[model samples]
Target: MSFASYHDNIELGDTVILYLSPTELEAITIKRGGVERNKFGDFPHANMIGKPFGSKIYAMNKRSWIMALYPTPELWTRALPHRTQIIYSTDISLVAMYLNLKPGSVVIESGTGSASLSHAIIRTVAPTGHLHTFEYHEQRAQLARQDFEAHGLSHLVTVRCRDACKEGFGLERVADAVFLDLPSPWDAVESATRALKGPGAKLCSFSPCLEQVQKTCTRLRALGYQDIITYVGLIRHLSFSHTKMQNFVIRPNPKGTNSNKRTAEQSEATDGDAQSVQPSAKRENIEAEDEETQASETAVVGNPGVKWAPIEFATEFMTGRPAPSVRHARPHGIFDLCDTPMLSYCFRGDGLIVQNDQ
Candidate 1:
């Protein structure tokens, strides 16, 4: 069957926690039967499956309602069921985007925590693609395996208890994407680089600090990886309120509505004064100034032939940032002489040859 067809058949369930009294489960009668008994209460599995995800499954007798159809990541994070610290949805989404992960691509993930990210990866790379996740911790690995089996994704996921970085990526073949979420990602960079398909292969490292990013980027560059960029994702949930909106619109705060009004008044006053003067001459002068500025802005900044060189740098090498003095190291190798150098010298593939002096 096609990947799309497989995704359609998968029964994605919403996890709900029911807080019930002692008498609820006994009072309610249901069919496709099994009651998941927790410390708080017992939930009837039969009554939940057919209901829409996020629908509240109310146990009237027990005075409880189960929150249904929440996202899998959310459910896994809250109810780990087993002991494990899981990767949150924020990291998962970023990893998926930066790595360009999709169906049919082979992915290698290490330190599978609670299998939250593993489930997300499986969902993304289904049918044609497969994920080979390694976890050195025995307990975490077992729990992750169980979670995958429960989701019926065991066929697509290969869980192994091995030190992925130390033993090298266990695959006989290279992977399209490699995701490193371990504590020390720098240690695994060499192995990950070897497993990646050089230039086009995507590698992502998840760290909570800039220090880790600095170390990882340094290693990646030394290993001949190009175009390496690092950034953090911050997701802030703003509370939507009509009262706050009205206050922002009507309140005369200096930084908000008051400043906006002052700017508008100043613009109107300037327009009136300009109109009272020689309007035609002023307009012509302003147009001329704008044209001059546009011409200067559009001037060919660098050699039009070379592809990788920054355009503006050639015209005035020291305009924005000082252009590095291209000192020929060994007749072929180009070296830069600058405190803060630009990466224009490292040009590969077919592109316009951007000269330092045009």
Candidate 2:
């Protein structure tokens, strides 16, 4: 299968992702007679020539190896330069699908930060479509242009170094969709309306704050845009691991009284009778008990040394039954390790959509 835009055998100047490891990847272009040197080893460019993508090449020392794979949009986004905050795939995928992008869609984008998403857009709107992207920052615009040319996508994209907020975009009723990722997106609402080809042309703006979304929505509706709706898009990754169950014998509370405590003779008698019950009867009893509990903050075992301490547990603790727990580093910790990102981030994707009146 095709990785990104690459479909033929690897040759000169084809960008590839050097998969050193799962987390360790380096984006590079395959150049003849060129060599890629890393701490692991030196990878020769000529060696990759004529080799189909997805080829694995081990270093001469055999101690290190890397996989040469196609640069899909997902991989490109992850490997792009973090010059500024770029849209994550959670929002990108939604917008692309929501806009109904295909092989002939025309798109307008403002504030092309890092042009990370632009690549995906071009990929979706290529072979006949066009993307007119406006970037306020001259340096950023120039860099984006370079990126398009480098990826051989310049024919499909037009990067303009003009401010869509103050000066307004230079297009008029020629865009199938408009995407704004600006700090003050409200200021460009009028411009977006003017850029749309007709009623039903999709308009989307990405903002980082609720205040921005509210302001943008107001501007969009006031500018005669119909059917405005807003939403925050989010993406979550779930993982599963083997959990080792640690049996914790229940312990008596310090303030236990006769009403709450069960006598050993009584408990033994009750247990004997419970064991005699049918399996279905036991399952029903256990399920009934699970329905009554909520959260947990402490785990006290029968051992005297183990005092009543808050036991960090997942939301599954509501079952009241202690199951084998697979410890997690916490969502906050995961966010932190991924560059101290916000856990509940709502990329201004779903926030507002102006109904295209046909």
Candidate 3:
């Protein structure tokens, strides 16, 4: 199966993606007598041959079935065997976009582990461009080359076995963009600079540690590379469900209470002498107004018989539930850096101060 091109029906020796569920997908090569055994049942390869690329094939038991999907870069990422720690699609997209990859673009990639990002890059630059990928390990390089040949993408990518940090990419002024994934990327900054076409060419480095990024950026800046920045890609999950909350009702205060109070104040003022009654009447009127203001301000809904209000949040149309999470590294520490001589941290009312003696 050519990942760069699409076909209608499955052919022998073609890689097929068996989509068992949203979270479960497996890749298999179609052979004449090969059978895929899973919890569902045995899915014979003979039954899958000649079927449509996306046709659903039932197991031998005929109770459960799986979708026969054509292989794509995204699906391949999920289904590819993990030869090493490979880059995921989230980071792949960021790298591709930042490197400004396009058709006819020549790219240099180091340490092509598992060929996950390599497939995606090949698809983006197929039919016109080429990818020069280098791997330090010979076995990995050979396996990646075989996979590329099987996918009919050998013309679009070239796999080489070389440690880029010590040997460098060998080619100069040939790459439009370069990607580095190594233990010490700073050691290859000079070599990457020599490989770029000229000014405006881009370079991207993937490092898990902040110190690595720091050293890489320093080397890049010293080599005259501009606009050096580091970013972390994070995915947030929003929970959607129905929540029950209390409902309030507002009712008018009874008029009888206010009227009875006013009447008594008026009677008391009338019993006093006229001179004293004038001031008393004014004071009584002010007091009545104040009481009314206080009552209006304090009015609240205290009814316990209110029906529950069902508050529904935004619903996920794709999964019909919470968003699916991608594999990622969890943070090891909770801390923030401030521009000061000492470090200060406030976590849930606990304050910590560490002096930066360096």
Candidate 4:
């Protein structure tokens, strides 16, 4: 059967360890249908190739047993030979979240570091997106490449042996996310920005010291990026048991009693409409009175008790009166009086007298 088919048929319990060749001891390749010699004993792949992946294979002669399949980050961390320090799962999970890395996001990671982080990124951005990782150390890069091939992720990742900081190599197109795991991540900020798509692109760095974070933050700001925040991850496991459930005897306090009372009162208040009617009515009456008083105080005519001034008089003074004076000053006379004089003729004993004024 093909190696790919062989890997597929192996069930959970089958024992398998990727064996390293003599020349490439750093690289671990899947050893099937062959005799694997170790200090403990000789493990024949013929016995294990047909079994399930997790099958417990015990060599009674050697008195050893190993469970198989691809190694998880935790198992790989403990087992993988490392030239540089590997990133822990805690940091890896946080980085993934902050970057918003999905299956199709092209990710650029620096310093493969036993390929622990690389392996995780591959799993996260699988099938669709590709991960291009750079490692300065040749041996480390080679080991990471081998691990990728063994895990069937060789097509998904490209491990380049180049000094990413000095040369800034292997950073081609704009990546959706960039993860820097080097000792001096600030040195790679320029390259990271060049590799990112735009302001939407995300870059995260892992540093153990506060000084490193300060330096990285400065570089990030200089690159015109916003919403930069640095925080440490802390995970604490709580011990829970039926016997240890919180009891009133353990935490006796007035605060707890008050909280319980408040909750009960709120629940009762929401149960029926009768208890809510009085409060709602009182609220409406208070609001209505406040509005009425405000309206009275702002009336157009003066209110002696409430101290309101006439709106018309205020508008006249503020806007200034019209320049042309009226013929009649009184309000009624201005409308009733006519500007032209009235002519009248009267006969005084056969003589005619005409008067222009009326």
Candidate 5:
């Protein structure tokens, strides 16, 4: 039943997750002479003992089978009996991330409702770290302690029955982070400040309403907590699939044929018979035609009777023009192109041709 460590074989008194389907799961403790009955069939606890943790065991009737799974925080969350409203895996992940939780992180949590998040927190800060959780309900606090003990995590967590919002965490400068999930989390902010180990320690409060968040934020600010940010826990599922669509082709209408006269139905009917060319092939053909056109147009012959200046390397290389001469040249200081002489600029090395406009 140890969720803090891994074991290969299912032993007596150990909790196992029975995976019936993707959406169906059950948690059962192995006890001698114990039997579990579901819509599938009867599963004997004796038959599961000594078997591998992941074995697929047949029902007593032998008509159905279910897989035995190693208990992890995630699987346990899915299978654990709900004593109250519990946090799901999505929000649990965000809590861990925002709190900067890791191994050896001392965490303080208030109002351990169903021990769902408690299990996840223990799993995160195991081996050397510890969790101090408080619950206002006395029965839930006792059940949480028992649950932790059954999972072999009693050494790593401390459970107390007390209202943290009123009594505080009852300690100071001990926790690396504090988490609050209470009706009036703002009331507990002062306690959280005392529990945290001074600066750099984080505090998170989970509230269902924006009004509660606002109050919490105000209290945190008044107490000198910095870098306060609010977050809403939301989970969105996206479905992906492969979709195939028909490729289309476009061709110019026949010369002298009025395209406007063609009805939408007629155009659509002709499209079915049009040649189907793959996009890649069409792109290749267009590129090849462009290369040929560029090669043919690159060679230029100067107009007759025009004195052409010797081509400069920069102008010839950049503009692909062989040579350019000043048109209607006047005195060096004057030009008829404009009232004031215009200074034409050109680049060095690889540059475009500079032309003096008339």
Candidate 6:
């Protein structure tokens, strides 16, 4: 009795995260009574039954073993076959947050890329919610479609092969959010508005260049997409330098910190606690690198240690004749436009134009 496709336990046809080597891991679907052959050794799928989602699987000889885990969205991002350049999880997570993605969220994403972000987005809105994703390349779209089916995610995703910039998103005001990861995202700003839902529907564009951001922001303002903002989400990962410990075994953390559990025991002279306590280092040497980056974004616009050059535009783009005051953060600076209640952004004093009724 095997489950069709689920995330909790290993299923016969579900793709699992296979630890290929010390430095590499990939996604491979499990098959009943099937064998996986590699340099490490042969792994039998029949032996993986009833194991938890993240349990480790050993080789037949028990010498070379690998972790046979369920594919999480984060794991999927790292292990997916890169049909195109993909956005890492760090940026993807924050973007998901900025877009206010929850269960049952209907969103639009342009240029599926490796479908890295799409997988994450689909997971967030699974079971009921759906994602309408547009990809420029038909082959990439088809490949992504196949991947979704393999992961049992096709029910929550729609991969369309269309140029969102030229032909538009082809979706009405049904999107709770619109995320753009394109070369020229400015061309689709107008199209995104058509697909976005009612007031306060968040939108985000992922671009590597400041020029692209500026152009896209400009177009978004022109098209009445309010709360125009940007973001650069950076995530640091800690890497510990390892030494060769052949017999090293990682045990479950008992209860409390090592340092806190000691010394006071000598003062109190408690034998029961110290006897049961295990000998473990209080701290380990660590190093962190910012592996995630999202082009700086937010709705909380503020004067953060930068010279703001205000504009005196009169009736250029906005409807008001108060001469919309536009300000630019000087010298390649990034602006963070946060939420401002009672701040009329009708281009009077603020540079942003009012879009929705809110």
Highest-scoring model, TM-score? 3
In candidate 3, which residue ranges exceed 4 Å CA deviation? 237-358
lDDT of 3 at 151: 94
Cα lDDT tens digits for candidate 6, 60-146: 989988888667788777788888888998898889888889989998999998989998898887767899999989999999898
Scored by lDDT, the top model is 3
TM-scores for candidates 1 onward, in order: 0.58, 0.67, 0.69, 0.57, 0.68, 0.63
Q: Is candidate 3 or candidate 4 better by lDDT?
A: 3
lDDT of all the models against the reference? 0.59, 0.69, 0.78, 0.60, 0.77, 0.69
RMSD to the hidden true structure, all candidates? 20.9, 15.2, 17.1, 31.0, 20.2, 26.3
The reply for model 5, stretches above 4 Å from the true place, is 238-358
- Candidate 5: deviation at residue 291, Å? 26
List candidate 1 segments past 4 Å from native.
Answer: 1-42, 49-54, 60-64, 70-78, 242-358
lDDT of 4 by residue, 79-104 (tens): 56767777767877898899998888
Instruction: For candidate 2, report its TM-score.
Output: 0.67
- Per-residue lDDT, model 5, residue 186, is 93
C-alpha lDDT of residue 259 in model 5: 24
Clashes of 4: 12
lDDT of 5 by residue, 119-213 (tens): 99999998889999999999999999989998999999999999998888898999999999999999999988988998889999988899999
Model 1's number of clashes is: 8
* Model 5 score (lDDT): 0.77
lDDT for each residue of candidate 2 in 1-358, tens digit (9 for 90 to 100): 2232558678787888888877778888877678889888988888888888899977767788888878877888887777789987888998898777888899999888898789889889878899899888888889888777877888898999989889899789989999999889988888788888887789988888999999998887788877887778877777766443344322222222112233343465575474554567545543543343211112323234432221222222223344233222112112111121111111132321122223
Clashing pairs for model 1 are 54-68, 54-69, 305-352, 305-353, 306-352, 306-353, 306-354, 307-352
Q: Candidate 4: lDDT of 346?
A: 13
| Backbone clashes, candidate 5 | 0
TM-score of candidate 6 against the unseen true structure: 0.63
Model 1: lDDT of residue 73: 42
Superior candidate under TM-score, 4 versus 5? 5
- State which candidate, 3 or 6, has the greater TM-score: 3
